[model samples]
Target: MGDTSDFDRFYTDLKETEKKDSVLTSKQQIDRLLRPGSTYLNLNPFEVLQIPPDSDVDFAKKKYKKLSLLIHPDKNADDRERADRAFDVVKKAIKMIEDPDELARCRETYTEARARLAIIMSEKRRKQKKDGLGDKIPEDEPAAYNKALWVVVTKVFADREKKRKMLEERANEEKRRAAEELVAAAEKRRKEEEFAKNYEESRDERRGTWRQFMAKKARKEGEGKSLRGTAFRPPKLKLETSGK
Candidate 1:
């Protein structure tokens, strides 16, 4: 709300006022830092070291040392293994946040969280104003940021899954259409072959009919010539018979 540029100032102020001289026992540290869902919670370095993103190098160093002493494996001999694991996480947190680049990245995520919160709250207030309700939108920070982060995460995953399904559907449709086209082409080729074969058979039948007609015409012409020859020979045969 006011000068929320970085969490370093917040961490400095919180360290001086909140985590100053107070020291927690190893068991207490374990309960607070090594709880069941701590693994996911500790993903954020700021959350891991229990410091703000705007924390300075001095503050990060102090917080790291404090946590180290509290959860030192050697100190917590009864639960050495868990203590070591927790200590490693704290050590990593300090190392990561101390770096300028990593710190900036953390700040970016926090800022993004803030931006999302603003959008959500603005929309909510707009709706309330429309409904004649007072604009009493929630002003929870870092927490609102977390909510915003979740919204982005869920949207990204949903969008990716939707795209994947659409791509799969497109591939399936293309495959189906290709199969249909292949079948149609095969049917077309088969019909063409059938037509060609029938055409050849019909041509041969016509040729045979034409040959038969030509042979019958030739025989009729020969018979007509023989009849003319017989008519010419008839007078010779009658005269010979009368003289006898």
Candidate 2:
């Protein structure tokens, strides 16, 4: 039983080693075949797409479609796993390069990456100079050392774009809310004005009725006084009694 267990462990280890070796072989092939350089092939999207740096929209779209089809996983099923990763890279590159907004973001990312690389290289150079190895250090290696810089730069730009869009949406929402508030305020003012106009008209009408009522009462009192003044009085009742 122990012997069988040992054999099983050895088989598993051997299989793991073989798998590791295969993965390593694939990695080496990818590095050798796909790596871009300044002299041979610039990794810049325009260069890879075989278009001018200032290519128009139509050209960019064409290049993106062509590259997508070329590196599509279905077409490269023999290495579908690697092909899928490559396709993703190509897609990201297209996104970073095609749209004007995305292109601007990419340029900003490139600038930041260059600045960071400069800082790192400057420190390295400073250290080398301090150690009396300045003569051995090469200045042409900064660009070469920035192999993974694009990945970092792209992420930063993507994050910035997301935040910018969120801010724009928030601003739009605030503007919409402000507009609604203005409309509501105007409606309230309209209602208030209407109420004030109706109240003023009603007050005027009541004032007219009160003035008419007062005039009518004054006229009735005058007539009653006149009638009392003009009334016939029983005059000489005293004289008649004296005759009797």
Candidate 3:
């Protein structure tokens, strides 16, 4: 806050730490690649390549070659597994840089960061002026501006990743539900077909049972008529006359 150069000094110290990565051994590079926060950090291809986002694809390709060699599994046979993973990370970053759409998105993220940083600096200047403090903004320095830009860029990438994951999950859920509905519809149709088949297969048996019932009823009626005709009347009329 006292001197604008202090901000520059702070930014310089951070860059110096990053510069040390260039000379790191293969083991160290693997460790850094697979570090605790690497998942979040690796969201930015620029961060993975250790290059500025504004760099052209050619420059990014060159950087990728150097980083790839540093962490290549063939170069570090003792730690091949980790080195292979690190190598994959580098490969993905280079692929993103080569892709026109992804490269454009990366550039847009940097632009957004710059725009957000500008708004923040503008607000800070406003507050300082209102408080009668001289309008000297530390982030006006190139180093300080870069340092602030880094923060905003990281945030933008993270937000984008979060939203992407959410949308993906939603789409997967919809697909699952649609698949289940298709299975249910197929099952319903199968049951209906099975019922129709059974009904058709039993038609002949039902007709045979009906014919047997009708024949039995006719035979009983014929036997009743035959009994009535053959039944004896006896001499009942003559006995009744003698009693009278």
Candidate 4:
């Protein structure tokens, strides 16, 4: 609705005509969401809502409500678990469209996908033009063109998904590495503290032992000097004069 009307129109046609040919029903989408290896596939909110990424917020809200009601656990009791999962995805999609930054990201992906398809379509048309045919959806081969367009869409989605997974994996790896580093740092600090504590205790014990040894040495030296001075005294002559 801002300055991307053409892009929005192309996306609308892709979903309504070509995309619908692949069945964009609530049940069908829910099945896909629950399928194995769908974690990355479900990252695209536009695909989750089965609508154009550039859709108005009001339209997206309406779609969310419709899909939520269709897949709400209270309504689908028999398949409640899968239905709940699907409902959660729809709710997440609603939130994504409501968030400005996330909405921009989805829009960016959609724009890139559109540009890729446009390039492929133009090239095919150019080849046709060179072959003496007009540069448009060939009238004689509507089915083939539609198939070609479908193939392009599938490939775009696949490529987008692959890139999304790579980025996600890289982010997770960084987080894991950070956590490991944090733990390692904590352990290193603890060991250093323990070593410092042990060193302080050992140092105090050595100081105490050195002080005792010096005290004993001083006492033995004083005893030896007293013995030397007493043994050198002239006592025998004084005893003889007292007897006489």
Candidate 5:
């Protein structure tokens, strides 16, 4: 008998532990929904609702009602704090599922995950066959397939979030630049207006200064004309003959 692959061994163990999660109590459900890293984990609506990606909107709505009621703050008075957070998560998930675009995107992510998993399985199986091992792949089973799909979907979501953050940063930078330019333009306009106002307000001063300068020049000219009109009589000359 061929030795079982590690991949197969994992699923074997996982299958043993798989239980019907539908019977979990309200508190257990709350804890599960609010677990560490649940922010990223709950991004998947199907993951949040604990439903299959292929589940229709109607089925999702039913699941939403159940989970929402279970974790609703009013219903879980003793644990209302955590219950509120959990409720919001469930509410957001249902909204996404209800959105036609979001729902389609969720389905596409699953479809892409499945397609990629199929290719990977085919390669693994081919390699196993070449090595003289059986062509069986663990992920061929439903449980293993679901786990693999979850991993793939998580990676896809992470990648999309990174790209979105980058785009948002770029958009924010553009908006900042636009705001700065607007402020700079406004300041420049304000300075120009102030300068014009100051120049206008000083108009009378400048005109008065010009009139004073012209008046002084005219007064000097008049004094020169009066002096020139008088005869240049040398101060009455006292003729003193030099006595030899």
Candidate 6:
């Protein structure tokens, strides 16, 4: 009975190990599938939540709210490792599709990817036609095509987003500088106007004082002459000379 119990315990441990190994294998596969360069499949909240491409504005907002809550770092603290990665991807994807320029870039990337895929497919078809094996085309070609397209799309969108952020920063800097310049110019103009007004007022005050002084002197001369009613003569002074 003791041997049997030991065997059972060993078997249970083996099974547990096998289960752990299976889980690890699955995690590895998921990591590989969602690798950094996967594609431009917009990992945004809306996209991640599988909102339709033509979803209404309100619906998109709702989708974002739902997904953000689910993947928020705070809410998924126990699984923060995965949640953070997913959140970052979602954030980047949202920003990529939000701004007009970024959206245009996304569309351009998609177009370019499609064009490249079409060219490759065309070449393959031509080759098959030439060899009379057109009917033997692989069923997985479409998947391969999509994978390649997305890879390019993702890279282009990422690059464009970086550039867009840089441009936005530059624009903000320019706006700040312009605002500062305008304020400085306004201050300078105000100072100049004030200085001109003060200078003009001072000049007028000085002119009035000079005119008043001249008037007072003239009035005093007239009064003296009127009081005397005649011109006054100067008295002669006696001079005493010493014997040389």
- The lDDT values for all models are 0.70, 0.61, 0.85, 0.72, 0.83, 0.60
Better of 2 and 5 by TM-score: 5
- How would you encode candidate 2's per-residue C-alpha lDDT over 212-237 as one tens digit per residue? 99999999999999998986978765
- The sequence of per-residue lDDT tens digits that candidate 5 reaches over residues 1-244 is 1354764564354333325466778888888788655777788888888888889999999999988887889989999999999999999999999999999988887777778778888999999999999998888897677777766787676666678899999999999999999999999999999999999999999999999999999999999999999988778778999999
Candidate 3 stretches with Cα past 4 Å from truth are 1-14, 130-135, 210-244
Worst lDDT run of 10 residues, candidate 2, spans 32-41
Residue 138 shift from truth in candidate 2, angstroms: 13
lDDT of 5 at 19: 55
Q: If scored against the real structure, what TM-score would every candidate get? A: 0.50, 0.44, 0.77, 0.59, 0.77, 0.45
C-alpha lDDT of candidate 6 relative to the true structure: 0.60
Q: Which candidate model has the greater TM-score, 2 or 3?
A: 3
Name model 6 segments beyond 4 Å from true.
1-75, 79-109, 116-140, 208-244
Candidate 3, residue 117: how far the Cα is off, in Å: 2.4
- After superposition, the stretches of candidate 1 with alpha carbons farther than 4 Å from their true spots are 1-23, 140-244
Give lDDT tens digits, candidate 3, residues 98-214. Answer: 999999998898888889988999999999989998788888898767788886887888889899999999999999999999999999999999999998999999889899889
Q: Rank the candidates by lDDT, best first.
A: 3, 5, 4, 1, 2, 6
TM-score of 5: 0.77
TM-score of 3: 0.77
- By TM-score, the better pick of 1 and 2 is 1
**Winning model by lDDT:** 3
Residues 129-220 of candidate 6 have per-residue lDDT tens digits of 89988644542376545445544555555666578789999999999999999999999999999999999989979999999999999999
Worst 10 residues of 6 by lDDT: 24-33
* Error in Å for residue 34 of model 3: 2.7
Q: Name the lDDT of candidate 4.
A: 0.72
Give per-residue lDDT, candidate 6, residue 103: 55
